[model samples]
Each structure stands twice: as C-alpha cells, then as structure tokens.
Target: MTDTSRRSLLGALGALTVSAAVPPAAATASPARATPSTPAASPSPATAATSGPRSSMTFTGTPYDTAAFARSSLGELTATVLPGTPVRTEIRHGGQRVAVLTKGARTVLLPGPERTFTENKQSFTDVFDRLVPDPALPPAKRLKPGWGTSPSGGTWSVYGGTSGDTDFGVHTKGAATMLLKDTEAGRYATLTDDGISDADVNCVAAFDKVPTGNACSFALLFGYRGGGAHYRARLSFTTKGEVDLRVEKVMNGETTLLAEAGPLATEVRAGDAWRIRVRRKGAKTQVTAWPAAGAEPTRPTAEIEDSEAGLRSGRVGVRGFASPGCTNLPVTLITGRFEVTAANWETPPSVTHRDWVRLLDAPFDGEWTPAVEAIVRGWAGSMAPDVFSYAMMFLPGAPGVRGADPRVAGADVLGEAGYGKPDSQGLRPVGADFHDYLERPWTFPDQTRRPEDGQRGNLDCSGYVRMVYGFHLGVGMMAVKDPAKKALPRKSGAMVDFAPGVRVAQRTGSGGSAPDLGQLQPGDLVLFDVNDVAGDPEDPDAYDVDHVGIYLGLDRAGKRRFLSSRKSADGPTMADVSGASTLDGPGIYADSLHTVHRV
Candidate 1:
C-alpha cells in the first residue's frame, strides 16, 4: 500500500440540455453565405458509423466463441512464458501483428514477428493453445474440438512453467503440463538463447502469489473453479548503514533502502547457520526465522495477516547463500531461493453479493443501491465472471472530465504499466468519471441556456447510478498505484480466490501500504450495515437493503458522504451515517464491521 488521494467530482454540478450545445442558425450557415467561393470548406455532416458484423451475442460469466475463427479477421493469439525460459505472446492476426511478453505492462514487438515465432508454429494448435508452448510442428497440425461444448468460453487460460517444448496437452483430455518454476522472486526471468535464470537471491523472478514485495511464492488454494490469475515480479539488492543487509524481493532496481535484507544472512559467521520457513493459509501468510543455534525468541515476523485466525499451511524450504560485507557489515539477500509445496491462488475479491441485513461485524455506512448491484450482476454475468473481480481489473485508474475526449489509458495508470485498455462503458478511470459527469448531464461551457438535462454526465439522479454501477470496477484509486496491482490484476479478487471476481467485502482499503483507520483517507471504500434502533432492517437504498461507498474522508461537518451511484433521478448523497441503517445489499455490510477498502 502507498499514498493515495480520492477523486473529486471535477465538473460543476448543474444539468445542461444537449440541444444547446449544437450549432444554431448563425453557426450552421451554408457556404453560400461565405463571400465569393473561396473553396468553401464548412464541416460536412458526419456520417453515422455502420455497425461491424457483431452478432447480438453477449456474455456475463464467459465470452461467446465466434464461429471457429482461424482467419485473421477475428483477433489476436497469445502465449505464456515458461519459468527459466523467456517466452512471449506473438499474434499474427490478419497480418496486423503484435508481440507481447512479460514486461509488467507495456507490450513490445520482438524485432521480427516471422523470426520470433518461427519456432512456435507448432504452439498454434488452437486459440487456447496460446496459453501454453508448442514447437517442432507447423500450422498444418491443428486440433479443432467441439466449439460450443465448454462451459467456459474461448479466452485462452494463462499459467506459468517450462519452455521450448511442443508437448503441451491440446487434444489429450484431462492432460495438463505441470507448470513448475521457483515460487519466490529474485529469480531471473531473462531470455538468452540458452537456459532460464535461477532465482539466486539478487536475481528476479515472477511470483504466483504475493500481495507485495518481488519475492515469488505459491499455494494451492481451495476456492471457486473458474478463471486464472496474472502475476509479475522483480529482484533488487539494498544497502543499509552499519550492517549492510542483503535482501532481494522482486526489485525494480530503484528505491534506496537503509539496508537490503537477502533471503539468508548477509554473512555466515564462524558458528552461524541459516534456517527459515514461509507458508500461506487462506488470507494469512506466515514466515518463521531461526539459526543453527535453534529456534530463537522474537524471531518469527508476521508477513501477511488480514483475518483473525491462523491457517493450515505447507512446507517452507531455506534458501542458502551469503556474500559477507566488510567495514560497514553489508547486508543483502546475497542469493537464494524460496521453496514451497504448492501455489494457492485466490479468486475475484470485489465483485460479490451483499445482503444489507447481515453485515453486523462491520458498520454498514456506504450508500448501497440495488441499481449498482443490478449493473454489477449484469456485467458479471455477461463476461466469464466469478463476479466483480474481472471488471475491476479492467477498470480505469482515473476518470476524465465530460468535454474531454477519451484516450487510451495508455500506461497513464500507476502499477498497471502494461495491461490497461479502454472502451466506452468501462475504460479509463478519467473516462469513467467524465461519463459519470455526463450521467449527471452536468453543464457544458458552450451550453448556457438549457440545463437540468438527464444525460449520463448531467445526472438528475438515476443515470448517475447506472453509470457508476457499470464502472465501479473501472474506478481508479490508491490501490491501483501499488506494486500489488501487478500481482493481483483482477480487481474483483477475494482475500484468497480470484477466479470469476472478488468478494465485495474485501475490495476496500487504500495505498500500496496499509494505513490507520482513525485517519480515514480519500478513495477508501467503507462497507457498513443499515439498520433501525432495534437492529431490524432499514431501507438505505429505499429498496430495503445494505450498502457500501467510496469514502470521501470525514466530511467537512465531520459527517461522511459516501460517493455512490444507484438507480434514482435524485438521491441523497450526504446521508447521516447515524441514521442510514444497513439493512440489505452485500451481506458483508454488517453493523459491527466498518472496514474501508483503499483503492
């Protein structure tokens, strides 16, 4: 978690008529009104765009597979890199080709497409085959399976493992290539014509499961059986003062640490020995430490602890090595490896169902709207969804002003250096904000005469709810800026699972680092209960339910106004937390619970 600021609604809040923004008689004058034909070049009527051949097909959980598409007219084909081996995703769709490998965010084309994929023609079994590696064979060897049979549609599934092999299981039913790689970070991921790099402390490798830090690790989680996860990592060495500690967790080669802490002690003295262990049980992760002398007191440090209880974990191997320092007693994760029995993955964290009545542990404070739920549910069902996780993963980090032309978010978003894309409904954070403004039908500079319009931006009420509902996943915030953004690309991930989407309750909080609750910051999502004095239900959304909100800090009057959108023409924004009872919505918004998600 790191520093973050809440996004303030940019445009002034006043409705405006669309007609007024259009040119009138004088502005719309024909070229005939122009003096002597000086090559009249008045703007001609813009033609309506013809719809491309898009079938009316739509998906909420899984995408619809177009008629077995082998031609370039359809789309791109991608692939995953094997551990130790540097792999890339190269697609030659319709000749408009592009190559993308693991570089965090921004995609790059290999020097030449033909040359780069010459060895991968065999990897081209089917579109989904791109998720794995294939070689030795050519495009002639193709495997076509029954199209409409799979419950999950055609999006290729991504995983991590071996390289340069054409033995990916394509036709063999139930056959899977065991994706094996060093779990901890600091293992090198570079590709040099030869073998893959090892995660020798100081070396960097991609991680399968980690909220932060570059050290790679894994766990076999028990959760939903849906989609997969995306991961990244970096390795670094830091220098401290007196005791130069060597520590390498995925490092970007930046940030000067007081001292670096390597996997093992920077120096092994005459009688010193190294012993360590790391494990993940659900949302909690434990790391124990010791020496050749045996279990030392005050040694085990809590790495990740979100819930109250501990959990059942796996084996923890020790990474051995150390490059001792001299005068200043240097420290660094000299070079080592973190071993694990398995990799546990969590699914979507934010997109979930909430019932306003049961959320008692946390305070139900956010403005819950059925319209928002409806929209989320709609989108979740439309895409191959577990729920909201995928939506949030695709959401923009910043919103744009109404009059501002939408642009490709284009790495403008923090942490999402390579993967952010843009579209109308849900694209860039700024675009979403601007669209929200339009839902308000907020005023435009040129249009002064007409106001109080019901546009997406100029909201009277309901439109705001609709737009917000659609793009809540698209809202950019402090969470998106954190290094963890790359670790967990699915915005809808749960504390443990992230297949379809995340559980709504876990999607709040801010920064790349944690924060104190008393000092509430902006862009924090507060989930709470809405109830009467008797603990009975109270209609927070007027539809009899619980709710949540994008916390705007403690309001000026000390009262908080949660920013939210619901299906209403005119709704109360600055509602009193004391009065609004969280009766229904996502059940997580209870009376006792008041956890804030900082994103």
Candidate 2:
C-alpha cells in the first residue's frame, strides 16, 4: 500500500455518492465504477483533509455509500438503514448489514466498501435478501446451497463454487453479532481499508455452547490482504473450563502460532461474553481478552514482536473455528459488536462555529444554544437524551423563573423577617439584587428545593461562567470565592480586567463606540458592565460586572450573538425576550459589551 495507490483509491471513491434508492433485489454486476447521481464539484485539498483516516458505522441509518463497493464478488453484501436517520454506509455480508461507516473529524482516506463474506441483517425488521433469488431451490437449500460441502457441516451459500464450506453470518437479534454456524473449518470476513498499518481491532463475543475440547474458538483478525493472509488472536475454551488465548500470523493459508497464553484460571462457560482486543503496531502485535461486563485489563493477555514487514498493513476482520473434537453436535458463536480504530493518522480539525450553529434548534446564528445545553447536561451528570429545556435554574421569584417542573416556579425564600435577622427585611441582602448560586443549592436562603424537585440547580452570571470553564470543562477559571488566585478571577468584573485567556479588544461604552470584533471566536466569553457599575474608578476591584455570555459566531443578518442565563428569561436563552443577545447592533446589551476572553 503506497501513497500513490491510496490517493488513487480515494479518487475512485470521491466520484461516488451515497444513494437513498432501495438496493436491487438480486446481485447486480459490478460496474466498472459508479457515477454520482447528483454531481458536485470536487473537494479541495482543505475540504478533503477535514477528517482523519478514521471511519465508523452504527447501521442506524439507511445503507448508503455502497455504489463504490458493489463490485465485490467474493460473497453477497446487503444493508438496511432505518428511515429518518442519517446515511451511514453498512458492511453486511451473509444476510445482515450490521454496521455503517462514519468519517472522523480529520480523515485523509475514507475506507471503501469491501468484497467479503455474504448476506447481512440489521436492527431493522424485514431484511431483504440480496442473494440471487433461486425459485427452483427450496428455502433451506437456498440458505446453504453450494458446489459441495467442506469437511465441516457447513456450506458456502453466497459464493457457491468457493472451496471453503464454512458458514459465516451475523445474528439478526438485538445487536448484530457474527455467528459461526457450527463449522470445523475456519471462516473469516474482512473490511476494506487502504494502507492501514497501525490499527486496533476489538469485539465482544461469547460461545453458544462450551466446547468439549480445544478445537473451537473465536478470533480477531487484522492486517488482512485477502486469501488467508493476516494476523489473528484466538480465544478458546478448554475441557477444564478454562480459556486459552493465543496470537497467530497466517500467510497465504499457512498458519504460524506466534504467542500463546496456555489455559488461564478464568473459567468460561457457554453464553458467557468476553471482549477480545488486538492491536498491530509496526512489527509488534498484542492481544487481550476480558469479561465483556468488566473493565478491560491493563496488560495484554498475549504479546509477540515480529519483524516481518510483509504483515505490515492491510484491513481488519473476524474469524470463527470449530472442530469435531470440541463438540459432536453443531455449535454457534455470538459476537455482540465489532470495531476498528486507526491511530497516528493525523489531519487538521476544521469544524467551524457556523457548522455547529447549524445543528442547534435555535433560530439563525444560534449555535451557542446547544453548546449551553450540552454544558448544562455535563454539569448535571445526566447526558442522556431529553427534551431541550431547563438549561439553568434561575433564583426563585425572578419573573417567569421555574425549574423543570411546572409546579416549581419560584424558590422557597426564607426571609429575614421570618428568620432571626431583624436588620434585613428580605431573604437577600440590601442592594444585592442577584444572588449567585456559587455552586451551592440554587434553592439557597430558603433551601427547600431538592434534586427531585428539579429547582435546586441555579447560577448567576459569574457562577455560570465558572460552571462552564472551571467546573465542567476544567479551564482553571478560579472558583467564585477564591478571589486571591492568580487565574481568572471569581467575579465577572474582575474577569473582564484580569482574565487569564483575555484577548485585547476595543471597549464600546454607553456612548456606543464600534469595538474590534475580528479576534472573537465562538466559544469565547463576552463580558459586559450593563449597569455602568465599573464607573466607580476609586474601587475598580470591587465594582460589579453586569452580564457575561458565551459568544456564538454571527447570525443570519451578520450580527454577533451570545448565549447566557438572564433574569429576564429566568434561564439560559439566545432569544430577544429581554434584550437581543447580540453585541454589534443597536440592542440593549450591545453597548455594554466591554471585553472578551477565550478560555
């Protein structure tokens, strides 16, 4: 695999686009190449290098991106993408399309469709058969028809004349797992990758029936270059109920055992799942296996160093083997999932602020809205899917302020009149309009709101800043009470002057001076002195900063916008309910935009 060859392969793939049209019922002849249904301009070098040479497929969406790999004649390939999901190209041979391919943020060569195995099933119901329909053959005969049966009790169904008689297929249950359909002969399927030398491959699988002897096993394969050439990590159960893990290198059908971990104390029983991991880096290869329900072991179960450079680079795959010595009856192996990750493939991270904004449900130029939602979810330790609501809980009694519960509108304020403080008439101090939650209960002063009530989360301007940078993202924005620290200070006003990530900027006062906007990025923090409280020249450190918000790039009309929790909105918002969250126009908070920080 040379650079010139990889570039040529990508060029061939660049011409193909994923189509939404349903696959043809029968195997179609592999055209010389597929033409784009909707032609677009070629990607520039910059655009082509946006993602790394990494791809993923979850088989969640419709089968796409197969036009480029439809020429595979080794076996049948079929895919099914659930409706309304994004298109992800699937690799399904043997009657099930279980995975899709997704490019990483920095990709150089997108993996092409492969020619391996046959048939595919998906999480979707009603898997359409992609094998050529044989009206003359019965259903059972069609399922495993072949030129002849191999030594094993399996037949090659898709590739009828192939010498191998082992049956290789993935189960169509809850999650797709490649099933070894009771075969003494080893069978494997490979993904199509170009020049992938340093790679990691892993999967979770379990034995359907414990082997009577050592002849049955599940395997992880890498550096596969077709025709039985690759590296394999084999895990098998012994008669003593222990597990045997080993690594082997195969070249053109010749097998050489490299490393072996003789039977281990860990007992393996039928239906007990284990995660097997194998990595090939340069001339060194390592393998590890552990209970799928437990954490992966820190050390490899078996490791071997081979200076053979021919086993340097290729694709990744899976294999299954069973013999008569292991079981008199037929057995099946269930593989829950499979994954491959290529390391050391570097490319630039070029996702733009505008791109992120386009994904948010907010109106034009409102990408920061979802970012804020994501931050809030991080703070709550609950990142599961939910309705986009209640980013921040404002102090009770702020107009329209409420928690996730409609019944919990305001905080339970314990007023000084009700308590022992006779000098103060209200729950908060005099001239202290906004009470910072300070990472404490948002239901402070009264402290009645509990986590179950959903009213206990709250943050003021500075608290929100600290939550985003210091607490959630660990940006070292010192805690609110730690005014003595050298890092970004606790209060909003202090941050405007002494922020660690502070960038030089022109200030726009009440008189409305045009500020420099070129230096700002989307995640930067914008500070404001909305009340002109910074005008107290004598005590600059003690003066208050009115507002702070997360900068969102530019809106549809080209106005710079930000996202923040406000008393007017009673929670986080990017809307114009109180004042537009913009900074450049004639909006209310625009004139108060004084400084910016990019922590």
Candidate 3:
C-alpha cells in the first residue's frame, strides 16, 4: 500500500470518540490580543481591563473542533454566557466591548470609548454549534445481517433465527441495528459472513459495550473453512482490555485450541473500537491488532506456523460469548470495514560464485588472504616449534601424532584410504615416502613412491612441498579424488608441471637467466639439478630436478632465505642464500642450481 493511504488507515484505527474531560493546562493560557487600528505596522501591547469571572463551561476534548470559528470572517473568538445577567453574553476579541442579548428584542453592540455603539444582528447558535455538534444523536451505521454456516451442522441466518433454535441467531433493534444478546447463559454465539476466501483478511469492530466476566470474549474470526469441521484463527478481546490470539481445529463438531498468545495489555472500553488482521504466506501465519484510531503497530501481536496443513483460506467474521455466572448483557458489535486481498510476498536474489584468481585478487585486509605464501607464513607463526619433521609424510589424522595404520598401507590418502600420523616427537611428518639418501647420492631427491607405499613417517622433498601447499594451504592444484574411483591420481613431476599458478623457467649456469631474484615473491620454489647417483657432473640429457626449497623472502641483512625439509640433523629449517657461490652449506644446494618455478 502507498504510505499515505496506509497512514490514513492507521489513523482511522486509533481514532476514539472525544470524551468530556478537563482541558489540559496549556489550553487555559490567555488567547492572543487584537491589533489596534493605528497606521503603525507593529502590533501594540494588550490593554488591561477588569478581570472577568471564572467560566463554568466544560469542553469536549476533540482536536480542531473549533476550526469553523477559526475560518469565519469574524475571526477566532469565544462567547461566555453570563449568569444573573439581563439576557446578555460577552463577545470577545478585536479590541471591542461587544455583547448580544434580547429584552423583548435581540441586539448586538460594539461600544466605543464615548458611550457610542455599533450594532449588528446575527444568530448565536449558528456560530457556537460548530465547536460542539449536537450531542442528542451520535454518529453510527446500521448493518443488515449476512447469511453463512455455523459449526453445528445446520443452516444459519444472521440476525434471524433459523429452523432450529440450535442454529446461530442475532436480534436487531429497528431496521439496521443488531443487538448480539447471549440469552443462552453459557453458550457462545458466532455469526460469520459469506465473504470469499482470501489469503489476507482485515476486520475492524466497534463495540458499544465491552464484555466482562469469566469466559466472556469478543473475537474476530478468519481463515475459516468447512461446514462443521474446519480450522481457523481468532483475535479475541476481553472486557479487561486484554487481547488474545488463538488458532483452532474443529473436527466433527469438536474444537481443539492449537496455539495462543496474550492477555496482552491494551486500551479498550465499552464504547471504544479495535481492529484485527490475519495474513497467511505459505506455512507462516501472522495476526496483528491496533486501537481503532491508531497507526498500525510495528510487529505482529501473535505469529504462528501450521504444519498439519488443511484449510489454507476461509471466510471471516465475528463471534462472542459470556459464561454462566456472568451478567447476560446485550453486546452490539458494529463492523466499520472488512477487507480481503492477496498476500504480498517478495523473494530475495541469489549470490553469484567467483573464481580462484578473483579470490586471490581480493584485498589482503589483515584478516583474510588467498595466496599459499600468506597461508604458509600465517601457519609458521602459529604452529609450535618442531611440528614439522624432515623425510616424513604427515597425512590428515586425529589430533596427536601417531604411527600410520598398516592396514591401509600403499593406499592414497585421498578418501577412505586413511591418513598418517605425526612423528613421536610431536612433529608433523613432511614426506610421502622415505628414500635412502645414503644410496641416492642427492640431498633433495624426487619422491619415487606414493605415501601409502613408503615407510611410515617418511617423505621426500617434493612430497614435503606437496603436503605443505596442497594439504596445509588447501590449494586445488593437488590431485583431487575422482568421485567414481577408489583412489586419486598419484602425485608426480607431471602433476606439478601442470599445476595451477606453476610457471617454470629453463635454467642457465649464469643463474641470472632464472626468475629475477629482485622480483621473486615468497612461496616460489627454487629447483635444482644435482649430481647423479654415480657422483658425476650434471648431464643435460638426464638432468633430474632433484632438489627444491620454498622462498621465504629477504632476511634482516636483505639476503634471501628459504625453508625446506633437509637431512635429519637440520629437519625443517630456514637457510640463507646470496648468489651461486655465497649459498650457505646445505645438503643439495651445495651441488648446483638449475630451474626455478613459481607456484
């Protein structure tokens, strides 16, 4: 609904009939005095005159009731009828002493300072009636009862008795006013209209006398269905000005109350009004209420969900009752308006997915990072010392470091193949399989066997790199398990060659031909082609990329440093390197450098 129309409806909801209450203190302040007939543009101070007697008048507390006098040509003024006077009442304002009265004739005089007077003849009731409308007859509407069915399995007529007295009935005074009397001491009388079913129903009722006593209730019914077996919701108000919301199920003439809320505090009186609205969207139902002349409340008075699910839409109307010991008084409920409309429901939009490169490009705002280098640095700072061990394959496992299970030996740790344990030193193993370096003649040798095929707690250089980058950093470059297969593809040089973000550069003896040292970022792998098993020099034809280390960027002295799992003595330690000759004494780098790969 448009906000303006909704506000108007809400205003109508809270509008109450004005009462005969004392005016607030602010209203007793003196009214504005009139300006003199002088040529000066500014207004003059009010002239002091004899103080008038206190008024015995009472005012009706409706707002802006004197609007007619405010808009009249005579301008705003108040008339006070004087007691013990000779047929005269004072007319005030305009800096004049004016009065209108009758002595065998009617007269109006605007007396001047020299006993001179100006006279006019006008009716008094025409002017004063605007402030207080005739109170003998109040404003109200007359309604003819509509026809509908009752829960007693019989035909029903509203405001009229059906064939059997067991059917619902209503009695009206004159042609249009219905007096809902609960003649049956303890029975509830309900009359529903034959309105079409709708998803949303709003019913506003004006009560002439708010009901009281135990079991006394006046309610609005919505979502009603079936003849005698149906389900519906109710918003009931008690004479104590408490409101209750309830949902019920009726089957074979029996009623079951499902859900209820309140006895909520509200302002209600014998001659006041209230409104109730019910709305259903899918399985959720909401009910709301407000004083007849107030704005719509921000939240629902009661909300409920029905999963039993039967009647989704139904008729709407009014029902009331009083208990046995309660006074059987006549209750007249007048409906100002009843509206039914389709529910308004809007769906939210879905989120779009982003790629890995886009994720890496996202801002590095301290809390989040996408690159493996950042992940490694964060892990290194948080992990306890000696957590990483050289020549050991640490598969995902339970908390503490323990030996691998032999039952799943040689099985890929991709799925149900199982994981390995950390070494007894509480260090995370860095190898997939163990290689005898004594016989291999190489510091960092390529892994020749899968993690499952090697001795427990052993891994080669490549396996260490794979575990740290793939398992620790969760990079997708690692071998992913095929959903239909029992094992994932083996990790080999071929997989690394085609891994995501992996860029390889052919090497030259000069070392300058490799990735520029100045441009290298952390996590870059420095690959080396070391001497073969025979202890001979490197051969281009059989140049196996045997050794690698993760670049950890420049140290305090601006020299480059990298971390790697070396021999047992060094374990996983950081090494400093400057140029080819200045490279510190380490297992494999002591031989020679070849290609470098950024991963």
Per residue, candidate 2 scores C-alpha lDDT tens digits across 53-141 of 21111121332344432333235445343232122234355553322322110000112232110001000111111231233446654
Query: What's the TM for model 2?
Result: 0.33
> What TM-score would each prediction reach against the true structure?
0.19, 0.33, 0.28
Better of 1 and 3 by lDDT: 3
- If candidate 3 were superposed on the true structure by all CA atoms, what would the RMSD be? 42.4
What alpha-carbon RMSD in Å does predicted model 2 have with respect to the real structure? Answer: 28.6
Model 1 C-alpha lDDT per residue in residues 1-599, reported as the tens digit of each score: 01111121111000000111111222211121111111111121110111111001112232233221223233433333433212223334445432222222221222110000000000001111121112233544432211111110112122222231221232322222222232322111111111101111111111122212222222212111211211111121223211122222212334222122334334334223233333334443333343425443343332443221111211111121112222222112211112212222121011111101001111212222343223222322121211121111111111222122232121111100111111111111212222333333222222322222222222212222222322322322221112333222112212122111112233233212222344233333444423312222353213212234444323222333344322110121222111221212222233323344332
Could you tally the backbone clashes for each prediction? 165, 24, 16
State the local distance difference test value for candidate 1: 0.22
lDDT of each: 0.22, 0.43, 0.35
- Clashes in predicted model 1: 165
Candidate closest to the true structure, highest lDDT: 2
Error of 1 at 6 (Å): 26
Report lDDT (Cα) of residue 195, candidate 1: 11
Best by TM-score: 2
Task: Name the candidate, 2 or 3, with the larger lDDT value.
Answer: 2
